[model samples]
Target: MKNRWIALYVENQVGVLAKVSGLFSAKSYNLQTLTVGTTEREDVSRMTISVKADDTTFEQIKKQLNAMVEVIKVIDLTTMPIHMKEILFAKVFNLNNEGKTEAFQIAEVFDQGGNVKIVDIGVDSVLFQCTLTERKNNELITLLKSRFKKIEVTRGGAVAVESISSSCR
Candidate 1:
């Protein structure tokens, strides 16, 4: 099935995530990614989800999601102008004093965008935090998976939508 990126603006309230997730689960939608956060307006939260669905089926999903009370708006940003970024935190273990070279090499992988920051480092563990587009972040993971023991990884689903022409950058 084709994939779609959808952005949802909703009233910031408890159970909002559950309500939207329920709709997708009920429809058997294959959710690939999701990200939610409070917007500039405290009362509004933005949600971005990536899912696989055919064109017609995707339309129905928008309809169903809109049925929920908290949902204020839903838009597919893939076709419109949009920018998306993903945050990744990874931990590497089994390091020693001699492994500094290898660790530096790994850090470079995430530093190109200058988003990767060394959050912490210890005798046997290295923690790195990074933010980039989903594609870029995944590529970095694939490159480092064999070199480091990626003990943990957490990603916000997706935050996407067409950019306003005046604000495009």
Candidate 2:
């Protein structure tokens, strides 16, 4: 199966998300990640949906989504040159001061000069916030999984847009 990313611009009204989700369920499609937020215009919302499907099914799904009444635009980002990222919020159990220091060091190294923030540090736990590419995020999770028992985890589904520039190299 090929992974696909689709962005939908829709009217910000009640039940819009439900209707869109229902369409996926009705078609027996599996949605991997879905992120929704208001656009520049308050009445319009942007949804980024991630799914895995074959070429034919991808086309069919896009067509159906465009036919929805509240949908303003549907962009298939999978085939485009786009930049995408996912945000992660995680809480790691820290049993002692040594564990806490280790957690902080891990976060510092994993930040990679990006938007990684230490949200909280308590006597027995540490919370972190990171915005990273999907691959890096997964790597972080794996690293943490081997080290600590995660108390909580949250993933902000991917958000993407077409790339604007060519190689600066």
Candidate 3:
């Protein structure tokens, strides 16, 4: 199954997220990532959810979401020309000076044009944080696995929007 991203514009109210998530759980659809935040209009909230499903399952999810009272709009982002990003903070342990230097180099390469940085450095653990596209984030993880001992990782689920034609561009 391919990854699908769904953007849901919903009324900002209690139990909205729960109700939305409950639908997926009830249907046995696997949700890979879900990020929710308020939009510029405080009364509305946007939820970006990533799931692995085929066309039939995705259509079912969309139908159920549209039926919900809280959901204002549902967009399938998978086929859209979208700008997507995710934040990841990874800690690597058991590093010596040589390992630390290697980690630094890895961070430099993966940082989205230098946006990523070393957030914390401990005696044995080093934390690096970066906001990157999904592919780059996975690349960094693969590098860490092959080169260093990974202690833990925290990822902010992906947030995405359709790429709109800008007058400035």
TM-scores for candidates 1 onward, in order: 0.87, 0.93, 0.93
lDDT of 1 by residue, 53-109 (tens): 888988998888888889999887657667777778877778776665676777785
| Alpha-carbon deviation at 127 in model 3, angstroms | 0.7
lDDT (10s digit) by residue, model 2, range 77-144: 88787888899998988458888888888889988676677788887998889988877888888888
Q: Any runs in candidate 1 off by more than 4 Å, and if so which?
A: 165-169
For model 2, the stretches where C-alpha displacement exceeds 4 angstroms are: 167-169
- The lDDT for every candidate, in the order shown, is 0.79, 0.88, 0.88
| Clash pairs, model 3 backbone | none
Given candidate 2, what's the lDDT at residue 65?
100
**Which residue pairs in candidate 1 collide?**
34-157, 35-157, 81-162, 81-163
What value does the lDDT take at residue 161 in candidate 1?
A: 56
RMSD each, Å: 2.3, 2.0, 2.4
TM-score of 1: 0.87
Please state the error at residue 86 of candidate 3 in Å. 0.8
At residue 46, what lDDT does model 2 achieve? Answer: 95
Residue by residue across 12-94, what tens digits does model 3's lDDT show? 99999999999999989989999999999999999999999989898989999999989999999988788888988989999
